[model samples]
Target chain A: MAHLDVSNVTKRYGDTVAVNDVSFSAKPGRILGLLGPNGAGKTSTIRMITYIAVPDAGTVRYDGRTVGPWSQQRMGYLPEESGLYKRLRVKEQLVYLGTLKGLSEAKAAERADYWLDRFGATDWADLKTEELSKGMQQKVQFIATLLHDPSLLIFDEPFSGLDPINAELLRDIILELRREDRTILFASHRMEQVEQLCDDICLMANGEVVLDGALRDVKQRFGKNTLILEFDGPDTFIDELAGTGRVRVNTRSAHRAELTLADGADARSVLDLALDRTDELYRYERVEPPLNEIFVDTVGEAEARRMQHESVTGTA
Target chain B: MNMSLRKIWLIVRSEYWRRVRSKAFILATLLVPFGFVLVAAAPAALGYLAEQNSSKTVAVVDQTGGQLADSLAAVSDDQLTFRPVSHPTDSVRAAVRAGTYDGYLLLPDSLLTGKGHATYYGMQGGGLTDQIQIEGRVSEVVRQQRLRAANATKGVLSILQSDVSVQNRTIQEVGTGADHTFAYTAIGYVMAFVIYFAVFVYGQYVMQGVIEEKSSRVVEIIVSSVRPFELLMGKVLGIGAMGLTQMVVWAAVVMGVLAGAAPLLALFLDPASLGVPADASSTAVAEAAGLSIPPVPYALLGWFILFFVGGFLLYASLFAAVGSAVEQQQDAQNLLLPVMTPLILPILFLAFVLESPDATTSVVLSLVPFFSPILMMLRAAITSVPVWQMLTALGLLAITFVTMIGLAGRIYRVGILSYGKTPSLREIARWATYR
Candidate 1:
């Protein structure tokens, strides 16, 4: 059962539809990646889910009840443009946010200490936020989100500022939260991170969901029609195939090429043709398209549809 | 619309602690009272120094050839000693130039017709106090001489020379009361100014606080857990409490300084030296000594707090709305002028309110919610205000503030999340109308 559900939610700002009939859910013990390009309504959807904003239409439910102040206390949201009070100490900042989330002062302090120790930030707990490095401040913000032990967590672009070491640590912590059966909504335009961490994915474009389901299912639905060829020699034959409309070239380089076969084109024939043209065919494989390709394809298709609709309706 | 008081309290506590611990808050809180103390003490200290330093001997060269010189010499005090000089005018002038005398007073002979003028020649001119003392003594001596020549009896002369002092009293329902007009005016003006400053400054602090949160992007995290209205109220209330704390500390400091300085000031000031009439009542003498400390108007203070809180909250919510609508403090300037106009307009009418508290203009202005905090306080301080007027002004202020908070909350909820160019007033109004 879904631990959090948003159904038929639509939010409009002035004449622009920021979120149009968006619907998605997060199940316990799984990470849901809300994937989108910039201005694709990912933040808007997260805002509605967290109750920072109310949907203009439809409902958001948590634990089989409409989301409200109760759900707010039980949820932790790290906004894309989130920050901490620059003049407040790390521990105090966490404690303040914890208390706002319904923890007692003493309990908030204890949790703050525990999280600070967990993140190896206990030494810098006394320092003001402004005194810390950007990565350290990001760690502090991450701790603030977990200090209340919220059942549902929402993080928007959580890894934008962290170094590799700290980012790895954050990834480990997020995985641990999943192990504890906490639902997570990770919203980002970073496709690689989403591919690595998300069990479920909801792809949005132009304020509408273009693709959504289990990550495996979403990939399978696209099929194994992509031909990845690694060869050293003339790649002129690959362009000839693309020009003939039998395949679409996604990427082309000196020694490698990625091509998506047409709807009825045979991957085996394309491979045989590639082998004949190349001087040395070092690698050849037929595989499903990567998430990056799928994301671009869907978003591009959605944009084309929107432009069509706008042109038809005489609206820009 | 589910609001949590606990969350609001948490926000308030954090906001309050954040500011109260800042070095700027501490400096601003303490510096104002320190300035007040310096202003209050400087003039009295200077007066004491001048009194100690001014002592001069003046030669009374009475060319009138009457008992004028003798009479002036007999009436000399420690600060100014008049010595009868028989030297010629040229030598007297030479003596003065040689520093043998501080100055020479020449009483020209005019055959008791008062046609010739009296002149004082000196190396350096005396201060105004010294000049008044010497001139008064010369005039009195001449007047006494002429009065005696006119056959006036001693009793008649005494009556002619004695000063008449008037005592101002106010009649009330209970009894007649001593008038402390000067003290009341001083306190009223200061209180009005303090309220005006507290409202304007603390309102700006709210704006700055909102801008800090929005610019820093912390507002998103905060609003997620707390309703925007709750957050807005918490900030306004928290900062208002901090301002009130500063006011309380200042009030205590002011009272302590006044209590400590009043006696010290009385010691330095002598009523007789100040030229108070010798035959005046003891109360008049005490007043002239500059030692009167009027009783604190507790009732007026209670009213002041009510208005200050109402006025601060009223402007603070609007300031917060302005803060949320803009990305930076500079962008808030155009919006701030309208919010600030109401707070500043009352100050312009402060003089009129103080001048005639019962005047219709003063009454009407005081009743205006925007102007009540300043004008009403001034009017109440200067005169007895009708209970209905006070209640009506407070009522209007309460309604306006509550309404403003509601409207501002709507604007703030939408504005804080918006980033980009500053919006216009029409856009803000449209935001307020959002469900």
Candidate 2:
């Protein structure tokens, strides 16, 4: 059974439909990347799932039951923005959030200590949140999101404002939580991180889901009809592939080029064409498209269409 | 939709404990009333001390066979003393110049003939106590002399003397008032202002609490756990608890100061200065008249708490709503002004209400939801307020309190997550009714 099932949830603010007919479910112990643009209804959908908002015309269920204290207690949410009391001590803030999520004060404090130490933020435990640097406060907020030992965690752009070292630390911690079978759902614009960490993905554009499935399945759905050529000689052979009716040269440099084959075309033909002209062909290979490319490919056309509509309506 | 008891309790506990532990709450609660008392007592104490430091000796040249000089001596208290001098005004003036006498007075020959024949002179001026004493004693002496000459003093015992002391009875009240002007004014005004100040001052804490949560963006996480309505209720009730605690502390401190200091201060103040007679005849007359002390307006204090709490919650709800709607304290200030406008309007007509507490307009204003919390208690203090009026004001306040919380809850739920800038009045009104 799904740990969280948000079905046909719709929300509106004024005349703006923040989320329309949004439906998704996350299996237990699997990470689902909720992908979206800035105004793509990710936060609104997350809010509805957590019961911060009730759906205008849908239902949200957790563990086969409706969202309630039972679900809210087991769920953790780290909003993209900093959500902390500036004047409150880091340890106390963590403990307060923990207790609110249903831990006892003693348990919350104990977990806060362990997390603070794990994050190498023990020195900041006694300091006020405002006294800490932005990165340090982010780490503290991250710790608060974990202090209750929640079964499910929703992180909205959690890696934002994090330094590289801290981000690496967070990446490792997320992997560990995943190993421990915690259901994780994160929304972010960072495609590389999302592609690397997410087992499943749901991409949103303009308050509606455009693509969603298992990460591998979604990638497969887009198909990887492409080839990579690495050589020392001029890559002008890629220009010939561009001339061919069945292939298009995606890029060409001094020693390398990438080519995408049209439907009913073959990567072997593109690779053969590249090798025939190259005096020193180091390598020729076929490869799947990166998630970023797929994301841009799918979302780009949607964006272009939106622009066209906006132009026609003069609403831009 | 799920507002569990534990969640609300947790929110309330946090809000309450955070403020109650602050040093500002402690200092303001314990010291403000003492400061007010110091302001009220400083001048009277300075005058008493000034009189104590300067003792006056006035010499009188009695042209009426020393009768007026002896009369002045008979009435002199410790503040001023009189000495009969066998000399003219010039000699007395010379003594004043020598600093042996602080001042002098002369009694003319026609002093006993109902003509104003007594004149006072001093190097500095007439003393505070000396002038009244001398005039009183001289008039008594002249009247005594006239009665002796007319042989009309022997039959005075046969005259029937009666005194009527007006005992103020309230038509439908538990307490009575003695003619004590001090107690009436003290109780009424003190209760009125205390409630008025707490409703605004503590109400600010509620507003600031909302602004703090909103500005810091912490409310988003909070609302995710507890409903915003629950969060708002917890906050308002928490601040209300703190306000009540501060009020209790202040009341205790004020009551203690009044208890321990009143007797000590009474030593320095003159009963006669307060318009009550100090002599035995006046005492006998008062006893004969049976003048009762006014009932302490203290009983009406329970009513004061009722209005104060009702008024507090009402104003506090609005303040919290404004706090949530505004992104900054400066914006909250603009909103606070209009919210406080209704309170200011009544103060303009406060004098009339105080003068005639039972007046039609005063009674009507006292029942007006916003004004009643302050104005009603003030009016009730001066005169007996009808039970029905008190009930009506209390009833209106209760309804307004519920309505305000409902309205503020709507605004708070919708506005807590809003950011970037202050919402306009129309925007706030929309939030207040947002479903």
Candidate 3:
């Protein structure tokens, strides 16, 4: 059974559809990346998933059953904007929040100590939350969110406002939680982080999911079949490549000329022709498209197609 | 139900401990009693010290064979030291210039028998005792001269003798004024006043508690786990416990002060030193006058606790709810008037209710839960309270108390999470009825 599933979820903030017709499911032991830029309904979708805001149309289910009051006890949500009582001691606040999540007092205390220690906040445990740095406070909030060991975790911009060291630490902790078979959904605009961490991805824009699939498959579908070659060749070979139906030279470097392959073209033929011309070629490489290139190309092409359609109808 | 109990208990425990251990709670509990002591003790001490610091000396210049001089001495107590001078006003004026006496009284020729005579004095105002003593002496002298002149009415002096005393006894519906110790009423009033202040002062603390939580955005975190009802109740109970603790300490201090007052007052103003017996009377004139000290204190205090707790809870719950409804401390003032009106109305009614506890209008006001606490306490101190009436009022007050908690909780639940919108009455009413 899926660890978490949000199906046909629709939420409207009084005529503003915040999350429209959203649906997804996540299995245990895998990270599902909810990827969207700012104002792309990421937070709204996460909120609906956590039951902070109820869906107007559909259901969010955990382990094949619909999410209800009981599911709230089993889900951990870290909101986009997190806050804690500044005057409270770090340990006390964590323990209080842990207990609020239905942990027994002893259990809450034990978990608080363990998590605070893990986050390197043991010394700051005695200090007031406000006295700590923002990164430190974020650590405390993260601990509070996960102290009860919920099966499903939703984090909105979890790596925001962190030094590299702390960000790496959070990354490691998230991976560790994934290893423990916890289903995770994180929303971020950082494509590199999502590419590195997520097995499944959902991209949203304008309150609707634009593209979502297994991260590998989606990248393959949007992959640009282009080869970046560095060779001591001349501009006449670029003309020869362009003569072959769909191959075009995109740029000329000081040491090389790069060719972009269009439909029904093989990179090896272009490479062979380049080699035939210059056996003194210093480097030859075929680079699979990076996730950033794929994301920009996919979103850019979609926007261009939308604009073209709008212009023909004289609406753009 | 279990979850609700668990959540409420969690909230209560946190609130209870947080407030109980707070420095403000500790200070308020310890400081207010000494404050009451100062208010009760300062005046009497000042009065006694003023009396001790000044002694009046009146010089009598009796130009009529020393008759007026001897009469002046007869009326003089230790407070008024009288001296007889042999010379006329000129010699007395010279003595007055020397500061030997505060002033002097002169007896002119043919002073007795209501004849034309005038006595001149210098200082004006604030010499009532001095003036009265001098006048009494002249009257005595004149009476003797009249008795000597008219021997036909020897029995006429008996008819002229009159002494007035008014006896006060306290009584009530269930207990007589004499049976109830005035000390009990004092104790009750002192406690009742503490409750009154606690509700007003600490109830504001509860309000500020909600406002703080709301402004801090902590209420969102709190209400997500524990319902706002739990939070509100927790705050009210926690603050109420703190208040009760403070009141207990204040009560102890007040009791100690009141216990010490009698000995201290007796030491400063010994009855024997004044040469006046407090209970001495030649006749039972005070009894015949039918005046008595009413058992006003205890009854008023009893009513005070009832109305005070009931009214305090009613109003404080609303205060807490209102506090949650607004996000800023400045905005809290908008909702304060309704709560404040009830609190201040009792203060205005205090004199009228205490004066006429059994008056129909006063009784009606006392039956009102808002006014009953202060008014009933005042009435209890002054007159008898009907048992059935007191119970009925308390019952109605208790009902109001429960209803307020429920009503306030509704506003709290919605308002705790609401931000930037100052909810109108209609919205709050909707919230109240929503769940």
Candidate 4:
């Protein structure tokens, strides 16, 4: 297992910065979630770490050594838009990828059969990849990533097309790898999965890292301003609280609503208002904002700022 | 950039095996040789069939008093049997019309002078060969009669009838030898065509392989473990090996068929029937009968392989770049023209090169990197190319392919990961400038 450190990395395509001064690290025994909206540079950052694309500036290091082909041998990356050779059989595809990662042919075949059996896809081994369903293809890709037993694992949207059962299976394997103390970087837009799996989280927006740290600590930093209310009456008081500019209603319905308390707003007052309007108050709790809200708040602010800057520059 | 040779080998092995095992590859590999066998054997088979159907018997009516019919009947061959009929002309015509004879020839007396036309009456139109045979026999008989009447000496007649044959031989600094110009030209043209076809076909295979990886989005995963250049080289080398395998199979099949078929063909064909001059030596008759198969130029074949490898790598790399820059096959059409132009230029100039392989223009064109594989091979086959020119052409080709591979690697590195509209040539050029 190795520590992956990407420092001050920037990647530009044409005039646009795809990954700008992005810095993060993942140590052994931890799952680092690379969270971002679409086009928020998560894939770009992962690519740099894997050495698929060279950064315009700064460095990507593994165990304090600059990453190169040697690092690549020890890193397994499952790209966001990964695919297999459509004409190649599943076992063949896995073996090719494993051998490319420096596994001997026999060992690759052995590992491939092992993984195929583990995924309960032994029957699909001789079938061409195109013959498999999208979910099955995803499972095969996951196996290919793990076949070489690399120290560092990077999976971008690994569970996107997988059914719940397969997703659960993948999650279990990832957790198992983490127990084995391998460094894992999981990049996805699914905040719930990230929250459930990641030990450390690095959130990016507008090609820059906006929030990053230990997941629990990052959530703690967001503070306990989010209120979750379950009630059984008219939700008019939720709208009334929003009108007062004391809270932001994230979602509202007649029976339940989630709201973020505005700065300097008292959670108790919001609860009292909700209690007064509802015929029955079932449950109420103040908690730190979920990663989903944090994602939106940080990326939404970054997008707004970019638009503002673009408008200003357009006029100038 | 560190490149893992092992990874590249793995890629090459996979690419080669994947295609070589495909039904399409097997069908194509086998079909080419089958088609070639069909083309090569069809005419010979037809000619043999026609020869079998050409036997005819003609009745001769002699009114010349010079006994021309007797002379013709005495020299009758199997294909044309002549019978001297003492019957009247009308009777002979009736006999021919009644199918007793294929035709009847009438020799009328005209004071022993060659002033009258001999009339042949047949049931149907005669074949050209039959007509020529009958006319030649009649003319020889009449000429002999005239020569006797004129009292010409036997030596003079022999001198007048002697056949002249000119053998073509090339005197070169290497050695003076009989020139198999026909065979060499044919083989040279075939080699050039094979290279042209292989380069275009295998180069596109490289392109298609690249595009498949890119469009399927598998390239990024592969590139993460292997450098882009190594990946590209692996693909090119792999596909090129497939092409070589197909060509070698074709060559072997064709050679095997020829080796097995030559004696069989000779059995079915008659040397005399092939129109070799009468009284010619047996060896000359055998040569004219095409029984002496020319030895294959293995050295030239060696050169052909060298140029093919160099040319394929050069064009396959460029094709891979084009494949990387496009998202679909249709988008590739526009970019293909530039790469295809150089390949086609050599073919367009093939006629000029073959017509005068020693011409300065041919020499200069053959030395050009893009044209050398084809034009140089043509020159080498048709004439003895000077050692310096061959070396220089090969050197230029080697340097060009290596440089092309490097440049193509740069473009491919960027283009494979990019998705959207197909980039303009200028934009692709800009990508090569990326760090």
Candidate 4 residue-wise lDDT, A52-155, digit = tens? 88999999999999998888989889998879999999998898899899888899999999999998999999999999999999999999899999999999
Off by over 4 Å in 1: A301-316, B1-3, B47-182, B266-273, B276-293
Stretches of model 2 off by over 4 angstroms after superposition? A120-125, A226-284, A301-316, B1-3, B44-186, B261-298, B432-435
Q: Which scores better on lDDT, 1 or 2?
A: 1
Task: Give me the TM-scores of chain B across the candidates.
Answer: 0.73, 0.65, 0.64, 0.71
The residue-level lDDT of candidate 3 at A106 comes to: 93
CAPRI rating of model 1: medium
The alpha-carbon lDDT assigned to residue B340 of candidate 3 equals 82
> Over 4 Å off in model 4, which ranges?
A301-316, B1-3, B46-179, B266-273, B276-293
Judged by lDDT, which candidate is best?
4
Model 4, B64-144: lDDT tens digits are 873888889888877788999988778888888888899898888872687888888898888787888898889988888
Candidate 1 chain B, poorest ten consecutive residues by summed lDDT: B169-178
Note the Cα lDDT for every prediction shown. 0.86, 0.77, 0.71, 0.86
State the lDDT of candidate 1 residue by residue for A1-316, as single tens digits.
Answer: 2499989999988778999998888999999999876678988888889898899998999999988888888998888778899999888889899888888889999999998998888999899999998888888889888989899999988888788999999999999999999999998777678999999999988789889999999899999988898998888998789888999887788998998888899788887887898899989888988887787567775664453453345332
lDDT of model 3, residue A139: 90
For residues B1-435, could you state the per-residue lDDT of candidate 2 as single tens digits? 243777788888888887888888888877897886666556656767877876778888888777667766776767777888988788789989999888887778777666757788877766555566667666666766656656775566234123333333223344353444446766677777777778888888899999999888888888777788878888988999888888888777866765555555655654444444444233333222222223455568688878888888899888988888887778777777778997677677677887777778888888999999878888877777889989998999899889888888888888887776787888878765444
As for DockQ, the candidate ahead, 3 or 4, is 4
